[model samples]
Target: MKKTSDLEEQLKEITQQRNLLLKALDVLEEGIHVVDSSGRTIIYTKGCEKIEQSKSDYILGKHISEAYELDDETSVQLRVLKSGIAVKNHHTSYITSQGKRADIITNTYPIFENGKIIAAVSVNRDITKLGELTEKIIELQKNLYSGEQKRRKHANGTIFEFDDIIGESDSIKQTIKIAKKFARSLSPVIIQGETGTGKELFAQSIHNYSSRANGPFVAVNCAAIPESLLEGILFGTSKGAFTGAEDKSGLFEEATEGTLFLDEINSMSMLLQTKMLRVLQNKTVRRVGGNKEIPVNPRIISATNVDPMESIAKNQLRNDLYYRLAVATLVIPPLRNRLDDIPILARYFIEKNSKIMGKNIKYISDEVFEIFNKYNWPGNVRELEHVIEHAINMADSTDTKLSVQHLPPHLREKFTHKHHFYKDYKVNNLQQTLLDIEKDIITQELINNDYNITKTAKSLGISRQHLQYRLKKLNIKKQK
Candidate 1:
């Protein structure tokens, strides 16, 4: 009798705790759904009811397939239950029995009991309204981008040509040579490089050089838009598809007979990448919420700020999509790797910004060149341009050249700490001269070997360890 009473007490406590947790979940803005192993809906919170436009009583105790318009393969909850895996930030859309559409990003997890999968839980966040808003914003941006074409004095939407790519490095020249070859064939091209390495510049150049140069050149940055809306934006949306969807043409259609440049393709969701691959393969695109397959003949050019193989290894990029898009690959070397171009680029930026700022900045000082050679340009040419623009902005009326004092404070401080006080040059200091010579020799060797430390060390007849130590002591770093 005593044991029975204790058992009853424990049951009561567990039920109470479960009720409390359910109540807490109900108060959240995101919907909470729980299902048994058999796919029956065991628990549905108030948030779930609100988002789905259905009452919890109607869903609870019903199999998920009957409760909602989802099957075993389509249902994330069921998928998690079967695989005992978590599906995180996965976007899906379905219609409620109430005739309302719910677009949501779901994070579904398998619930384990005693090390066995017993149930599944899902947290769904409504992105329907956000998707609508993004659509409106995208429409506005499309108009804005279209209007800029006239201002740029270019047909379609391209402003830069091959000549605009201001780099003399062999790597850049070779990349351009390959891009020009790709432009002749109407096949897809993939440009891979670090951020700010002008991957888009190469993409635009390829488009301008292609036969489709006369047609529209549509460009989209995959990372800029939400994954939920990106599909509708890339593929057209049909009117009556959602609450406020309209009959709109997607970028693929917009760039028909031209080029579609997908920047940061690695940022696209795998599901979207699959859709893109299908469209590329078929040369046709279907509108979201529509059943029509629109034929598109746009030359595809995709750019990624990540290595294709690395992104594929990490599962950030779809392997099939990478292979499909990389028919022609162009790799633009980072600014640090092409150190020889720095002087020419600096001079170009100086002249350009000097004209804009109404200054006569004629030269970059020798000391400034030395500092440039030492610093790793992580942000690449864009960073160099911005640095030059900033120096030009800060230049005095009497100054004829950009000097150490005129450099951005961060660069100025780094140079001062690493090298010497340019304000007080010590020409007779033999130790300082020797240090300068050693630093110059190392810098030259690094450049000669394409910044390969091992090769540089071997050429200098020093151990790799010794070279690394010397590099660290000298505060020399490769671009990240």
Candidate 2:
């Protein structure tokens, strides 16, 4: 009786341990299945039922080939059972016995007893959502590329007109007059100016006012494109020219019967400049891999931030190309030279931004204007506009005007430093001291008035010619 009781106790303990192991397997998130050496299912978890969309009873005790309808090559467990080798992270798509499809990444390993294969166990994770996500990403990429291609195709469209340009200074007015005259002519035009001086604004205005207004207006930044690709971009390429090359129209062809505005023309490579000169002379283009010449009639309007003559001297721009592009030339004066226009431009920007930002700003404080007058605007009109926008955003909601407190931190610090420098200065030489003070005053007034030479001279109680002489004597080159 004692021996039988001991045997019964041992059997009960084994059953309890087996149940505990099975319970642990059932709690796993990944589907776990075990197959005997014959490839028949010996264990199946609830996770397997969820993954395969079938009950455990339908899988347990059934052959893997019968339960999952998998062949030797497709069934990971069967393959592991036959080879006694583990299949790590094998991916496959399968349909369950109940006709449910799933994409899964599975790991199947062979169980060993005394160095012989006893069974195979598999852990599976469904990756259907991951596959769907990959397809969505590919679709988004195609759409993005398509949109960019469309933008390039319609690149000739003008984004601004003559009325869009702001400023009433004589220098600006004269530039506009010249640009208007150039607009009526088909001769290629070259616009030269410093950075941030609204060169593109003038180019766009000229295009919009010209007879080509009805046609496309394509603009290209020569410096922005890689030298290796600029040639093909400007003249296009033919299919079979190289790997993945496609037959496409270049900017010149796209802007046919319209205007082709080449910005930063000085930055173009010499080889590209040679090709451009040829195109200008012949009024035709040949694709990169094509020998057939295609007639192109785009009115070229080129611009450079630096002096074209200087560019020619430095060999950065081809002399022949310069002469061709400079049939008419317009030089845009910099903001420091046009200080008298600052208030006008500032007020315009304030009102514009007020409407855009939904603010009730009605005025700009004199303190703000004082700071504006003292600061040298190296970035020109664009910088001024941005400053005003930033101030508006920083202004108090209840305040009806922008003040110095709302100015950029850099500008405030600069003003403070300059004030201290002037306040602590000790006059050692009377003439030199007076001259320094005069220069400082003139510079401030010039900035305050938006660099309008006429207004600045008048404000300083001197003639415009006198102001020009002082500017030269002071070694102050006009901003540009």
Candidate 3:
């Protein structure tokens, strides 16, 4: 009786442990699939069901290749079972029994008992979303390159030039001067500026100003692309590089004899930075999973929204790559720093947008300009242009001026709340201050009314004769 009772207890403990292990496997995010020596599925996890869009009951006890609609030669689990070796980090794609395509990065290990391979256990991570996104990017890249090549035969790829830049500020002028000089050289140039400060504008201008102006100008934003695919995009890819990789020319090869603008270069990974540095130094590129070296001579122009030195300190950017790319550097001053240019930029945008929107906006009001000057433009020139565009949209077709009421709601609310009644009032002797304030009010009213004395007097609640007398006393000149 005692021996029988001990045997029952051992059986119960084994059952509990087996159940716990099964629970743990089902809860994992990655699919755990186990197959026997004969390639029959023994264990199929819930994760597998979710990823493959099939039920475990339908897969378990069936042949691994048949369940996943894969062949013995292509199946990682079957390959591991046949070779008795572990395949680590293999990128593969297969169609499920349900006929849905699945992309996975898998690690298949041979399970052994008594030194003989008895089964294979594979851990799989679904990368279908990432794979689809990569495919979309590749398609877009193909379209872009083909379009650019076609356009190159007709005209240059760049649309902007130094003359297109609308800034009279000393800071911008100085930056542009240095950039024009950099354009004459074949040395790599680095542009540093805050976000929305038109780093790409300067890059394109430099490219158009250079000897390579007639060649293809390719621009890619490093920060906008996925790190996993960036290397393949920049260095090209080989036919067998990954599951679906093909023999494709990268940005460097496409930009050969032209200029390749890498915007936000600091966003690139350190590993990619090292590889890029090697390519830059050698003036050639080796495709991913390819052994052949292709020579490229594109004028490399890299930009960073952040300070490269700070990026280096944080280990986000490689110091060596920075030095190589920054042979000639141009720093664009932010909009806040170039406040003197606001009036001109605002006017320029207003005129440009007016023609586009078919509105007759002739000027921005004094109050609107005051708000613009006081509010720091964090998005720099882009934000200013957008603000002007938004204002024009709000203005009536007959409206000759954009006013505070026409400003974007958020900007209007922000600066309007901070505006004090006395903020613009010059404090001095009571009589002089009052006289000055009155003169300013009458002058603004006259301008707002198109210098019509009758409308100004009616708007100010004064007689026309008294308004005329005040205008003369203040020596205010009205244009005919």
Tell me the whole-model lDDT of each prediction, alpha carbons only. Answer: 0.84, 0.81, 0.85
Q: In terms of lDDT, which candidate is stronger, 1 or 2? A: 1
**Would you list the clashing residue pairs of candidate 3?**
none
- Give the TM-scores of the predictions, in the order they appear: 0.65, 0.56, 0.75
Query: What is the per-residue lDDT of model 1 for residues 297-389, given as tens digits with 9 covering 90 to 100?
Result: 899889998889999999999998999999888888999888989998999999888988999899887768888999899999999999999
Worst 10 residues of 2 by lDDT: 137-146
Residues 293-357, model 2: lDDT tens digits = 99999999999999888999999989988999999999999988888789999999999899889
Candidate 1 at residue 409, lDDT?
89
After superposing candidate 3, which stretches have Cα over 4 Å from the reference?
1-43, 55-58, 61-100, 105-125, 134-156, 355-358, 396-398, 422-480
- Candidate 2 segments whose C-alpha is farther than 4 A from its true place: 1-156, 418-480
Q: Rank the models by lDDT, top first.
A: 3, 1, 2
- For candidate 3, the clash count comes to 0
Q: TM-score: which is higher, 1 or 3?
A: 3
Clashes of each: 0, 15, 0
Which digits, one per residue and each the tens of the lDDT, describe model 3 over residues 1-480? 999999999999999998899899999999999999999999889989889999988998999766765667768788888899899877767778898888788899998999999999999999889878776865564345454445643255666789888888899899899999999999999999998899877988898898999988888888767776678889999886654567999999999999999988999989889999999999999999899999999999999988899999999999999999999888999998899999999889988899889999998878788889888888999999999999899877778988776788888678654223333665768898888877777766675555667767987899999988998898899755
